[model samples]
Target chain A: MTGVIVTTINLTAIYALVALGISLTWSGLGFLNLSTGAMYAGAAYGAWLVATNISSNVVVVLLGGVIVGAALGALICLTVFLPLDGKPNWELRTLTATLALSFVGTNIYLWQFGPQFKQFDPLFDFIREFRIGETLVQPSKTGTVIATGILIAIILAFISYSRIGLGVRALTQSVEGAALVGINRRTTAFAILGVSGAFIGLAAVLLGQIYFVEPNSGYSPMIKGLIVALLGGLGSLRGAVIAAFLVAFAEAVTLQYLGGSWVLITLFVLIAVVLIIRPRGIAGVLEGTRA
Target chain B: MPRGREDLLHYAGLAALFVLALAVPFAFGTLSILGSMGVFLLLLSWSISWRRQGGDTLAGVRDRSAWLFWGMAGVIAILIPIIAGTSYFLAVMVTFLIYLSWNVMWGLVLGTAGLQSFATVAVAGISAYVAGYLSVELGKSGNLACVGGGERILGVPVFQWWVAIPVAVLVGLIVGFIISLPAIRLRGIYFALLTIGLVELARAYVVQDKCNFGGGQGLYGASSFIPESIAGDLAGYQLAYVAAAGLAALALIIYWRVNYGRLGLLLRTARESEPVAEVLGTDIVRARLWVFLISSAVLGGAGGFYIAYYGSISPSFFNFSTVLFLFSMIMIGGINSPRGILVGTMLLMYVDKRFVDVDPPEARYVFIGLLLFVVTIVARDGLISIPDQIRRRRGVQGRGTNPEGDPPEDVGAIEQEAHMPPGSRPEPS
Candidate 1:
């Protein structure tokens, strides 16, 4: 049970990181971009690209993901929407176009690198065991999850309260209104996409450490991140975090009881059911925040 | 010729070239590369017209020009292979006629209803798997050969192909309806995403379980529709061309019926603004259901023809690339125009095949990437609508309007500078 819980927490932390980026894109950008996987894959590929240079520093590996992800995110948004400017169909077009680009990115990477799975470092070295009653269990990944979860919370809170945060909120509500207030829409949008992209890139690096990285690697988890964003309601950061844990835990438990292959099947089913039952997601849209 | 008249003449001349296209098998005198193209053009015409029929006010006999053009072209296509003695092309052309019927149905749903679907791929895939499995088990042998390769599905008796098409369509409709039940709740990205889930599920169930091996190498010759030796050979080309032509014609008519028909326009209203359409008293749910079912039935029929054309079907071909590419074909052609879309596929495939010639198979990615880049830059509205876009820009005609109002409409207005998702506010409370 403890082992399962630890795995759940670990996976949830990764989901939280990925979902936060997805939430930002959905809530802030008015996009349902499913290309987070491409960004995440970029990081893993970045690490693989410079594996000899970076060696094994966990921070370095993640930074590789972050920098590449942010760059790609900015590139995608600017390139995708600029051409589609003013078209009310921008949202759907953006989603479809981005998806195509993502495929291109994935295939490009695959063609250049060739198809192979690479193993990265696992953060934890030792597993510790403890028992409450008669049940025996070992807890691994406890530290990684705890430490990262705290960092994400702090960073998110800081953004929420800061002056820059205020400007971001304005843009989210109304680009014209923000411009009316002299928030500099162009600079601000660029800044936000860049920062948000990099942040998710870091999340991808963290995920790569736990799972095997390949072209299709980020897709399964990216789907989860999108679900968490939707389930938690668009733009709800806390909701995404919580939903991440819920999904991760449910998935881990399901895998523990049923088998490994069933985890994805379960998540897909879960999202379908949840979305049908609650279209607005579990978090509900924030009233105070700019929609 | 006057420039405008010349342009119309070019269209008419190209439109009239269906006679030449039909005669292709005979002209080429071989089931070589050109004959293969003949087969492809016919199937593409199916989906292309369905897309064209979208957002139109008329659907039936009233919208006769496009239908008439398609029919004339299709008849011309049929005669070419017959005159050229290209039985292979004729046979392939025959299968595509069946495909055209199905693809038009999908186009009606997709073009008319405001739905972004990926499940149609899965629906067709499932149909193919079913037909293949039944055909193979019943006694068909040669299942591993790639398309156009000189191979035959030896064991299965020929009669089954006759039964497979309708069965495949029925299965497609049933699946489409089932998917829409949950699918209706999803809007925008969520609905498209759900289809991906279904696709993966199909892959896992069909391919991995090996009951169908539905996940991996799709299906091999389950039924003996045509012999490969004759189809791939020079003499076989005419047969394939004629068959492809007939199917294209049949599909054009059905698609025209739905798209230019009353139901298709109702679908258009729903897609353009479902809520507004509902406010205006259109049964939004019913429209969604109707269009989706139409698409599935069409897709299923296509799937049956799909088996006949390829002599095999595999899950690998049905993966994300297939979905993305087909969607790209739709976008590159123009969302609601069938004529443009079919033409788009021909252009894209031709360009794609060119890349295959120049690059190592793996490096073909670079060419497609570059081509996609160019297309996105030059034809953001797709190739078919380029003139319309230019006219709109020049104010010669101000027809295509952006539905969403807030953001700047001209993509050119936004600078090519990297930025956040515009919504990435710090205080996304």
Candidate 2:
């Protein structure tokens, strides 16, 4: 039971980070950055590279993932979002383009990294495991959960209170109106994507501790993030966060009771039921604003 | 008078093309080095010299040469298996036809219906598994290789190859209806994402369910239209190839009837503005559901053919990479254009089979991805629109002085309108 709780909290943290990234990009840029998975994979590989070559200090490893993830995000923004923005069928085109870019990104990673799964040196070696009542808790997982909470709190605070956040909100409300007020859509897009990429990058590092980092590792996280973002509503950060927790709890419990194979089936059924009930999702924003 | 002369000329040209196609099987006999080179050069020249307009080119030739083109294509498709004859290329052509059939239906879902449901392969794969299970494993004539140990399932009738196709169709319809549920409610990317999740769900279920789905090892020895005694022979592959060609032709017909038919018109109007389409009493959702169901049923049948041809299937069929490959084919082909779909599938297959035979083996995916990325970025509508883009570019540069360029007057107007957002453009009056 404790294991399930720990797993759920850890998964919630990772899913929230990725879901927030997707939600932020969709609302801010009106682009469903499908390469979010590629960014996640790239970030994990980046952190792995750092742990192997440089010191495995937790901060240094995470910074590597964040930096690489942000770079990939910026690359996508320039390559896919920037080039295809304002084009005819912008939504569909960008969606397809980003998906194509992900294929490219994943293959490039596979080409460069080979197909071997890599394990990171335990980053939380200094922290020791402890017990709460009869439950034995591993320190790395606890550390991951707490660190993710702090990082997400910081990201959420920045998005909620910062000047750039204001720009993103305005742009999400109306592109033309925001542009009319001298808000640069390009800059806002870059910033949002970059930050979201960093968020998922950190997620990659954290999750990588639990799972093997491979060329294809990003896909599951990407799919999970997409589901959470859609369930919470495309642009609703709060809804995404809430949806992340709900999904994580469901997944962990399914894994605990129904076994891992049935997890996705149950999750899909749950998502379909929810979607049928709430067409716009829990807090579906940008309903009338977008086509 | 002149009309008779024109018709005579058209008949003469078509006859010459037919003769050329008939001679191809005997002429090349195999996909040799020199033969492939010659074919490459011929196709390059043909594409370059083809009409330069966008969809209008097809519309322009619709009355005159459209039938001629399709007829010629049909002849070549029939000849391909004979041309490849027992060579490894025959297998490639068979797979190509199957993918062509699959992509045509997927194009309907993506381009015509404007829904990005990514569960196409899942629908096909699930149908194949179910059909293969029912017909091969539990049928009255069960194979010894199956888990049933040749014992027929209780109360089940003889499910031979004939029953497999219809069983697949029924399964495809059920799966299609289920996937379309969210599509009816959710719009755009949400439906796409949900379908993506559903694909993962399917993969997980198949991989985990060992008894029924055969887990990762996959079920083998599927019932084929060809007799079991000769299934391993060259004749079996040839027959399968012909059947596959027939299937591709059937899918093409479906694509035509749905896209050019009344449902396509209503869907297009709905695609533009659903509220407006609703106001016009279009029953847009019903139209979408019908298209989705039709395409899904055909794809399910194709899936049945897939297992029949390959004799087995595994969970890999439901993998996201397969979805990527299929989507790339659609992207590289101009979406909704049958000609583009054919061109795209052939080009990708050529590259997949011939070019980029590199170490690590997985590098081919990189090539495919790059091809897709480049096409998506540059062509936007896939490789089909490249000729138009070139003509528009030349018209801009030469101001109609260039002999090959289209008229410059409306080219500029078309370019301007093309670049503008559809909503911002003046409503067509």
Give the top-scoring candidate (TM-score): 2
lDDT of 1 by residue, B156-187 (tens): 35436666767777888788888989888677
Query: How many Å off is the CA of A279 in candidate 1?
Result: 2.4
Candidate 2 lDDT, tens digit per residue, B164-199? 888899999999998887676788888888888877
Q: Write the per-residue lDDT of candidate 2 for residues A1-291, one digit (tens) a residue.
A: 887787788788889999988988888888798988889999999999999999889989988998998888888889988887765567778888888888888988888998899999888878889886677777778878887877877776877899887888888778888989999988888888888898999999999988899999999899889889988998888899889989999999999898877877887887888889887889887577653
- What's the C-alpha lDDT at position B247 in model 1? 57
Score candidate 1 by TM-score against the native. 0.80
**Where is the poorest 10-residue window by lDDT in model 1 chain A?**
A135-144
> Local error of candidate 2 at B254, Å?
1.4
Clashing pairs in 2: none
DockQ of each: 0.28, 0.47
What's the lDDT for residue B258 in model 2? 77
Error of 2 at B37 (Å): 11
Query: Residue B48 of model 2: what lDDT?
Result: 33
Q: Candidate 2: where is the Cα deviation over 4 Å?
A: A156-163, B1-65, B140-157, B355-357, B388-429
